[model samples]
Target: MALQNEKNNRYLLRDWKPENPTFWENKGKHIARRNLWISVSCLLLAFCVWMLFSAVTVNLNKIGFNFTTDQLFL
Candidate 1:
């Protein structure tokens, strides 16, 4: 069942056929590209956050954390 809820700006598509050229030309391409970029950006941001902690830990002594080299390695 295809339902369009204008008040909520929601469209429920019961069937999806991306192979249909008309649909892809009209809407699918834009949606797909937008989602792809969003996903890629989120992944990159997550990777940066994950790596930032390691960088901070490596410089903990410089920041006055009093961590020894051995402790830093651990």
Candidate 2:
């Protein structure tokens, strides 16, 4: 089981020595850019959801849903 798990995790970066220039040039740069773009995309998605909720809450009463102000904010 342990050997199987190790084989499964062979591609995982357990040591992560980005300070080594050769490793950085060969692999670290690609990994860093991938992680950065993933983070940026997730952040953008969260912002869009927040804006949609805010707009809906502000206009809920105008659309005939009688939620209290505190409930809307919540």
Computed on alpha carbons, the lDDT of every model, listed in order, comes to 0.80, 0.88
Q: Can you write out model 1's per-residue Cα lDDT over 1-71, one digit (the tens) per residue?
A: 22335444544444466899998889888778888999999999999998998898888888779978888
For model 2, state the Cα shift of residue 34 in Å: 0.5
Which residue runs does candidate 1 get wrong by more than 4 Å?
1-7, 11-15, 61-74
Per-prediction backbone clash count: 0, 0
Candidate 1 yields a Cα-based lDDT of: 0.80
How do all models score by TM-score?
A: 0.61, 0.80
Show the colliding residue pairs in model 2: none
TM-score of 2: 0.80
